[model samples]
Target: MTRHQTSNNRAVLRTAAVPARKTLGGGGAAFLAALLLLSCSNPSGPKRNEAKIQGVVYRNDTRTPVPGATIVLERPVSVATAGEGGSYSMAFTADTTYITNVIATMPGFRSDTEQVVVVPQKTSTVDLYLRADTSSPVTPSQSGDAANIYLVDFTPEFISVSGTGANDVAKLTFQVRDAHGTPVDSAHGVTVAFSITNGPSRGEYIFPSSAPTDPRTGKVTVSLNAGTKSGVVQILATAQVGTKMIGSEPVRMTIFGGLPDQAHFSIAPQMYNFPGLDWLNRTDQIMVLVGDKYSNPVQPRTAVYFETAGGVVDASGYTDAAGLAGVTLRSGNPIGNDPVYGPGFAYLKARTVGENGATVKDSILILFSGFPTEMTLSPSSFNLPVGDQAGEVFTYRIADRFGHPMAEGAAVNVTSDGAPVVLSGDVNLEFPDTQSSSWTTFHFKVNRKESDPGAKSGNVAINIKVTGQNGNRSISLTGYVAY
Candidate 1:
């Protein structure tokens, strides 16, 4: 039984090799043997050798052709792509390491790559698997975002990359395309942006070296440095007919690192707390920590300031020379009793001087993670008309942070030291309109505690105490009421 299984497996393997069949001729045997060795051998092994790779490009799954698909071949060392018909073949220099890129990508479908494949044959047939675009009436941005990238001309439809030297200048050529990828007479204006990473500045944006215009053929040059760090960096080009950005594309490149080193600032502790790690009250110490890359204390002249949207806390502090300085923010109002933590974040900016008095900017943001404690006091004054009996009405309202009638709420704690005053039962609160976020108002009839309407008017203080998500607040009103 074992021998039978082995024999069946051998038969299946040979059948799968049908596509690997060699063409007839005198060197057929030797050629087939060599081809197998090339495809099967690993370039990293001791038996490494240069090999030529070539393949026809086709739309994935379907037999449709992708004409002029730029085939770029690149590695740690050599670099190349493809041209027309979605095909690319290049030689990987013997000194090169890793797989050289043999990529085929169209506008609508995903890209496919054939990397360093050791092969003995003069040519290789590696079919790509590209997904098709099954969408309708979508813009290019949307089309590419979804799995559906539109199929584009293998060679750029309108322009080609022109110029030379990724270090000083490189040219890009293209025919103009409208919002739709259709070739237009020209783009009104074109600009390309460049930046160098791991150099003087990481992601330092610069304007285009050469401007482009509407023409059958357009060309724009890009300037780069020879010593830029060898890594993937972005190059963006924008073409504007007028004020609108018509079409933009990004190109990626890798260059050697050998320029001015760039550095950035940092936020200390990553979190700035007003009353950090402790209770927020008059008895606590409130301080802000300003940190940067050096982690050393900043000077008072650094010009640091803090601002919050809620305006509950006052940020007035300076970093000592050691980068560790603290300032205590004083809170005396109702905020101290029940504070509103945060419905937002706060901004902290630090400015200082570099060489030649040049200005340096460092900004940081801290999120409000904790709840606020809001405590309010209420009751603005209220009055009742003459002859207002137990059934009559007297109205009063609660106040907010500002001394104004905020809204309506039921119940009021009436108190007087001298007079044995009396009030009515069954008080009702009304909310015809709410002026403030939180307000309590009610109307009540005072009982005939002192039924001397003809007597002199009396004075009393009215107050309403309420509590909610924030904290406790009270409204108090002092005014004279006719008896």
Candidate 2:
């Protein structure tokens, strides 16, 4: 029997239509209202000073701790970082009343906030459950026992309609289900049809649009050609189930045309040093934002072209749903007079053709600040007699991120431990000191006569450290001397 017939027979056999439905719906509404009100209301009696706050943050669906979430407390504001187990704690002083407000936040997850009353010498715990952001255009799930079909999702929600036919296709995916709200695997081999419900007549679902659902998944895929015109296209899906046909409610997608209204551009870690010895592992990211005149993010997967000078970049790509596109740029070798140990610049440009065939463009100047990243000893190992003055133990070198020697005169401090080896020269020596002309080296000697012979037979550790003028980075080198 059809679903409607089954419902009718049940209704007539029992009293389920008027009184039962109305009574249950009314009770449910009232209960939900009360619950919501109670949750939003604050407690009235609160006067305690020695209270403690602690809680764990969990993913709403998985019930697992959300490590790295940040929790903040108001009123003499304080913050704490959640531990690996997603637990955090904060203490409030005794003798002061506090209606503490607690908030927890993490990127890509909805933040949770709550207010609790603190009583003297008591512990108030508040556990937070965070929901993942589901702000995408497509969401799929069954509601009730209904024989309905719908577009679960259509990838690339927006399309840039160029005059060419090859660039106008969008993939449309949908599902078929039975009246019981379960995917109808039996519906496999059943043909599903696609059509553009709202768009210029030029738009069409490509041939073979009437394809059978997959035998295992009850899903179907088809291609729709967005017409040359720019506007919103509503794609609809339908399939026949049993003797009756079910139609999927239509979903809307967009096609862009005309001059783009806006463009945004930025570079990640705008300041970085060129990776001299390690180019493959270091890179900067460039992000571009393209939008229509209305400032709405452009269509997903809209191709954008990138051009850069003074760097290497993976520049060709498309913008995502948020109208954002990203490319990685690795700093090229420092050129000309730009110091490899100082600041340098690279230029990047992003451009995309709007529907009107006009170029929408933006550019950014990526600044790279170079700093010393490595310290090395010409002779890494050293050995000394227990009672002798050693000369020029080893030449220490300082290099920037690009492996280029820093300017001469960089000052460094040396220290020794375990076996007090007396530094024979100045404690602070200029890099590549007067003894050598190299811009990055320093030579120093050690007098080990004062080293206590009983201490591991006068084994000593010599340490050399240097800090740049800007304090952006500090580099240190350690060498061990053994008798």
Give the candidate number with the greatest lDDT: 2
The TM-scores, one per candidate, come to 0.23, 0.31
Residues 1-483 of candidate 2 have per-residue lDDT tens digits of 111111113111111111111111355346435644664473434554545677777655434467777776654345677887688988755455446556676665666666655555766666765565454112122222226675766666556554532256678777666654445454234688877678745544555658887654457887776655566777777776568677887777766642344443332333333332223335666677766654445567777888765557776877766667788777565331333323344556777776557676776655443456766765655666544454445667666654454333456787777655557554585543111225555677765545465545445667777654313333344444444
lDDT of 1 by residue, 342-365 (tens): 323344444444324444445444
* Candidate 1 local lDDT, residue 459: 65
Q: What is the Cα-based TM-score of model 1?
A: 0.23
Task: After the best TM-score superposition of candidate 2, give how far the Cα of residue 30 lies from its true spot, in angstroms.
Answer: 77
- For each candidate, what is the lDDT? 0.37, 0.56
Q: Any idea how many clashes model 2 has?
A: 6
Look at candidate 1 and tell me the lDDT of residue 155.
19
